[model samples]
Target chain A: MARWEPNARERLVRAAIDLFAEQGYDATTVTGIAERAGLTKTTFFRHFPDKREVLFAGQELHSRTLAEAVAAAPAQATPLEAVAAALDALAATFTEDRRDFAARLLAVIAANDELRERAAFKHDQLAAAIAGALRERGTPGPAAGLAAELGVRAFDDAFARWSDPSVARTLTDLAREALDELRAALAALG
Target chain B: MARWEPNARERLVRAAIDLFAEQGYDATTVTGIAERAGLTKTTFFRHFPDKREVLFAGQELHSRTLAEAVAAAPAQATPLEAVAAALDALAATFTEDRRDFAARLLAVIAANDELRERAAFKHDQLAAAIAGALRERGTPGPAAGLAAELGVRAFDDAFARWSDPSVARTLTDLAREALDELRAALAALG
Candidate 1:
């Protein structure tokens, strides 16, 4: 159990994922998760409002990381560059240690429509936060929003590549590649 | 009611929007919409599966308009131009006659979380259709996806502007302005 000795929140999350993967999300109850983690239902409730919340607990942190990175970009950086830099910063957070966990979480989300909706909502929230950060840097409407969305799309593409088991590239590398492709694609559009 | 002497689907849609605006989406029922349209609940069911489907009835038509337009673009047209052409085709369908109805529909969607989710889902569906059409034209992944998304964003911004009561511009004109702004913003990324 030494490998499993973590905080209650982490323990509960691990147990929930395992149960969800084993018995399906709908069939896995909070009590089942708690019992598997050798904890109480009350502890599970303390950590997450519900089973679905566990899958999205990092949303706020993820949004802050991207927005703060965009906000902190050099004053001379163009809006697109600032957004690209923000994507790089966020990508760096998805280290080798997270690949397996991300795969599991993504698979769980893929298997559930309710979870997919929540994921889409979280993606929108993150994009809006990035757009707000761009606006703070004096980028105007539609422009800021469009640039932020492009950046998010790059991050999303990179995350998918990095989460693949056979892929050895870092998230930052994949994201930069995806951003370049996006730029080239836009350039080709003209 | 001669002004509303249209098909049952349109009547049901009009009834649903009016009821949603007056009593909120949660309080509006299929029976309420049918009664408001002076039609039977059976007619409403034949046109839409439920109350929620009324708000999203146009998604398939919107997606087809975009994809078909993209597919028919001149071979020499840039990916962006192809997408721009698609937007113009779609904008032409949203005549001045739709401005008031569109505004009321948007307001009802804005006032309801479920409706907003459905809208986002519809927007994504439309973007994917555009990307597929771009791919059929030999544009690659990530690039096709990004360009398609940018075009959709332009349409979205333009739609908002077009729907405003005080705005006098045509949807095509607003979309052109928004698309130009997007191009300039993308170019500034370098």
Candidate 2:
């Protein structure tokens, strides 16, 4: 059934985000989202457990992407270097076509406390994934955790910029620059 | 009326933790918790908004403690130093008497998904409060955020250790040691 529906998952995500932005997240119902998507409530449930999850659909995939990238980094690579590789890999997934949607999604999340909390949970989960991967490569516990944090922070900072209309640089470039800036900021902490 | 029910808040918290631990978080109810506390449901409502909030009663106070300590640091203090001071101040509130309750609270949270998510949200909120204070003290954005994260992480790590019966060190000592270890780990990231 899903195969016959074409891009059912993508369509549901777009429709949900559109409705959330239009009517506000709190007021938008899953049934209305399904109706707007030209799909059924059953289909919506099939793709997402609930409306809140539609906005964070990429969490599991993004976590896997990061972990795999870290695991694939050269054995001799430093913790931060491995983290940098993971960030580049993850950033490549956010193509120009998704920029507007990403921007709107950020706004919708910012306006809702539940969504913001879910976003923070997703952020920590991604960091955990990256940290776990680094640890598997024999990076020490605290270093792995700190490096993973930097990677996620870099991506998050870059993502905000990438979502903006005026930011012309690629997500990859922005993430790299953000990571470099954070590394330098370490000195300023002292 | 409130003045007559001395330590009602503390009694409610203790009862809630004991109930949550014995019956499991999901199996517990506000009415049951209130009954265990020798308080009315109305009194329970006066203390907490919901059953889940009972386990996280200190969130607001903890955030204010971290922020105030950061704000009160000397003008010459560095970002990390300010964050360290905040951690020490926050850790001081968790006296030896609360160790058993703290340990039980952690176990209950770890066993429940909703509780874990709320814990993570509280962690980020604490970091944000500390970061805001650091920025007020003229710290740079990235550095402030990073320092605050380290402070929170240190406190979290130290808290787990402090909760252990075998760990004789004070929360302040454990938190300070954890922060120093993280600072050292920063060098290992590269």
Candidate 3:
């Protein structure tokens, strides 16, 4: 039987990110990540399937968080309102302590084509999750999808801004502001 | 010196799609695709970087077509109007002759995770190209991005509908209708 490791996942992620940043993502290996975290390769495999997946650690949990929040919105709430609530829930997961890590993660992803592609897939998945939740709440197809897209765009834009060390606003506040900007921009599309 | 092969790209694409549909994507290989196409592996490499890229053959040309159309829209055209023109231009490339191919291509992509990720990346790239062109034409940041996303969504939805053998409408018409429906859905978002 394998011994239980404390915060093994978190430690592995930090180690992977540090290694990726130092030696470049392509040069980093699973064994190196495991060794850096003081864990066995088996422990690393238990948490992540590969080095690339380590960077996308919370994808499933984030998707669930967004969907559950959208599902829990008031029955009478508009699609956009539900999306707003979902963004709040997602943003809450990115507390102040993770801001620097978020910035570094963004830089690493931006530097690599495979990582960028994976990021785009994750973005689409998140939007789809929000859209599915809205549809379950009786929102029509197009509107559900559009509202979900807006929510994701807002969260993504706000995340980029929040990752900047100079930005003092909370992720939730930035997301709300970005969503409002997009809502206002819709009228100007004409 | 290598002998030139006529329609090598097209032949390779058709062969890949057929092979992927027959034996499944994972079971297929570049050498197998080249052999089925009656071309050499070197010729296949000349056209596509890998087997997966064979399915996304016209990606660069499609992006260029969309961006150029958006850039060439009338000076007074609204952002959405520019996107509509871009969609029409893009749809023209997918004539009736290509409908069956498009359907097969979509099915092959739908069955594979790696291909789906590539598709999402391509989708984002197309949207970004349109957004960049819109920005060049004086459209603001948020509105340009929102309009570009709507255009991509409309075209994607229209392509799916047009892929059905029973759908008689032209790709252009379906895209226009889809865009109009999304525009109307915007009003119901709140």
Candidate 4:
């Protein structure tokens, strides 16, 4: 069904980012975004429920990928190991191709308090999804929740590192390094 | 100044919570809350900037408590220990007298996605405050951020436990237990 719409989703997302960057998020509207994309408002609605959704459409994909990766980890892997695996898989999706878009999107979000709140909620949602996956893999209670949160923090640090223009490292490499730093930090706490 | 205002803030908060719980957050208005509290709209505005503020008036106090506790920790304490001290001090403020209010507030926030987003924002604010305090004490990035986040998670879990009707533990005790569990969990990550 989505194939029939060609690149409507991508076009809408790009149009949103461009308009948001040009005029600020508060000044942008769904209708204006659709027009910028050379698409109808109806077509825009089919892809996203709201203007904000355009900036966050990839969340479901990211969450699904994370959960699936955790679930597919080796049976003997510890909770933290499974979480690290899940984060590595998710980091791979943030390939170099998306770096420019991510940087711009983060700038727009950083400028708006509402968007920052939405980002926090999105992070919590991913943590919860990852925790659910860990629980399914037999990790219990606070362990699963703690490991899930640590994974998200590592992803955040790695993504920020990867987004830096001066950093030539891949997102996967950055993520692994970030996880190692966090694990060492945790061990130091002991 | 606040003493002259008597319990006007408390009255307004109680009225807002009762009205919100009865008629829902969206349906409850400032005017209705003021009327219920035997106060004028002007008085209500003087106490709270908005309806939502009535439910979250303690945030500033909580943030201050956390930052102060972190700052007051022994200079020799590790980043994680400083964070634990902050959580402990903040938790001590949540005496059994506030349990019912905390439970109701959590219920209201949970029922409304907008409120929940605001709650997440509040959590982020506290985390930032803790991180700032930790940095002030010479802790560096990633270490301060991660420790602050772990502290917030411990407070959250402990608060939930303390709010449980079947649980008779003091918030301070619950917090200690929660932080201990988190520390063990983090160590097990190794």
Candidate 5:
């Protein structure tokens, strides 16, 4: 049980994710998550602004890590390449055991209209962050923007492939393969 | 006023879009749309299930068209290609004249979380419709799903490009171009 000693925050996430998976997102409540976590509702609030916020911990972290990776990239690297590398770095945080939870979270988001909108917003934010980082590194207007969006799409392709139950490769390996596939696909257009 | 004749449906849509674009989605009332359309408020309820339904008149039609297109495609066609052609058929309806209303409607949806959720739900429905169509056309399981998702991503890319005031082409043209781009990128990966 040492590995399972969840803090209040982790407990809330686990409870929320589990209850959400078992029943449904709409049926899950802050009260339920808190009670499952052995904490009061106030504790849940302290850790997250709303029930929705608790469900998005991994997403927020991914965004931060992705942004940092893009920002730290070398000068003169193309925006798409930089963003692709950043995405790979983010994927390294995932492990084989985490794939099930991640996949469930993704499916849950995909299954719900409200969560899908949040996911889209986060995708936009991730692209914007990458574009901003690119501009700072000297990439220009729509080029940076388009590259960022494309990078995001490639990362998405990588994520979907990686999260599949039958796919046994590491997330980074899948990301590289996805990036290569993306490059080939885009180049074919030209 | 021939162009603005009392097509009650059109009038309602125009009024609703106007109110939504101007006052923000949540704050605007169905009564406001009715009043603006010069009809009784009760008539608004007659035309729309709720205020929210006013913004999305032809989403179902669009999905059906896409499904039919996908179903009718050649069995040998690649999954992504088939879905792109289907979506292209759907894109044909958005002429340059509709750009303003479309952009405004998008902006309104973007500003409101609830409206955004509804939009995502609608998009997912379209994706499912396309996936089912692919299955009917003899495309395999997860490949069909991935193709449907890729098609959605292509449509999204084309949408962002066409919706930009700086973009100089129709959605179909942009979509075709993006599809080519996708093909090239994927080929490069291979």
Candidate 6:
């Protein structure tokens, strides 16, 4: 249904970002975004609740993609391995297409307290979602919770590394290294 | 300089929490908290910049205490264990006198987004402090960062479990358990 909406929800998001970037978030109005996308306020309202929703446009997709990635991991993969794969899947899903927007959105969210809190909440939700998926795969108790959270935390660290142009490693490489670091630190306890 | 404030910060915090629980946070004012503590408004303002200061009152001290705990860890201990010991130290500090008020503060911070964000930021600061302490103890590079963060994260997870009334485990036990879970997950991939 959304596919044939011409300038659909995603298109509105792209137009919104462009407008927001060009004129700053607060200065850019929904009407201007819709107009730029050749979309209407009704269509925009049909797609999103408000302007801030544009910043979170990729979150649901990111969460779903991560869930699917965890679900698809090899049966023999360790919990962290499964998590790493899930993060990799998310990186793949974003591709080059969403990289700019993802980074921008992250920066905007980082700078805004309310948005940062929302990001933290959503990250917890994703961690819970992954933990549940791991439970279905025979993972247990706090181990599952730790694995899920470690994955998200590692993702955060690795993504921070990967997103920086000065960062020398690929996203998957960074993910692998990040998990390796998690391993080494955990092992140091023994 | 802050020491000559009369009733002291701790007294003020206790009084504030009591009044907040009795009359609610929004309904309670600094004057009321100070008056309840039998201190003047000047004394209250001397100890705290404002009313919200009491709620987040322990952040600096908490970080310092944890840092000291990590630094005091024995050389034979693994990074994770040492970090765990630091957390144990902090727990012991809590159990000594003010655990109930601490628990109430945690609950209050957990319920409010602004407070939670501040809490999260403080955690980040604590983790960074731990990382610096690790480096001082001769841990290096990303290893130090990872170890410090792992310790902090593990401590956080363990504390959450330990503080739960339904969870019967001690913080050390939970920390060990979390490390075991982390070790198993990481070893599977290693």
TM-score winner? 3
Could you give candidate 6's per-residue lDDT for residues A6-46 as a string of tens digits?
75887898888787677777788989988998878888999
Candidate ordering by TM-score (highest first): 3, 2, 4, 1, 6, 5
Return the candidate ranking by DockQ, descending: 3, 4, 2, 1, 6, 5
Task: Give the lowest summed-lDDT range of ten residues in model 6 chain B.
Answer: B93-102
> Can you write out model 3's per-residue Cα lDDT over B1-190, one digit (the tens) per residue?
3446888889999999999999999999999999999998999999899999998888889899999999999999999999999999999988799999889999999999889999999999999999999999999999999999999999999999999989999999999999999998886764
Residue ranges of candidate 5 with Cα displaced over 4 Å: A1-6, A140-146, A161-167, B1-8, B31-49, B63-100, B116-190
Candidate 4: interface RMSD equals 1.4
Candidate 4 ranges beyond 4 A from true positions: A1-4, B1-5
Global lDDT of model 4: 0.87
Docking class of 6: acceptable
Q: Pairs clashing in candidate 4? A: none
TM-score of every candidate? 0.88, 0.96, 0.97, 0.94, 0.70, 0.73
B10 Cα displacement, candidate 5 (Å)? 2.6
* Top lDDT model: 3
Question: For residues B106-157, what per-residue lDDT tens digits would candidate 4 score against the true structure?
Answer: 8899999878878888888899999999999998776788788878888888
Q: Give the TM-score of candidate 6.
A: 0.73
- Which stretches in model 2 have alpha-carbon errors above 4 Å? none
Candidate 1 per-residue lDDT over residues A71-162, each given as its tens digit: 99999998888988898889877779879877888899988866876777777778899999999999986678877887887887888888
- For A37-91, candidate 2 gives per-residue lDDT tens digits of 9999999999899899999999999999999999999999988899999999999
Clash-forming residue pairs, model 3: none
lDDT of 3 by residue, A143-189 (tens): 99999899999999999999999999999999999999999887676
Tens digit of lDDT per residue, candidate 5, span A99-123? Answer: 8877888878877866876776666
Candidate 6's displacement at residue B110, Å, is 4.0
Better candidate by lDDT, 1 or 2: 2
CA lDDT of every candidate? 0.86, 0.92, 0.93, 0.87, 0.75, 0.72
TM-score (C-alpha, index-matched) for candidate 1: 0.88
lDDT per residue for candidate 4 within A1-190, as digits (tens), equals: 5655679999999999999999999999999999999888999998898999899898899999999999999999998889889988998777688898878888999999888888888888899889999999888877888789889888988887777788998998888889888887767666
- Model 2 chain B lDDT-worst window of ten: B181-190
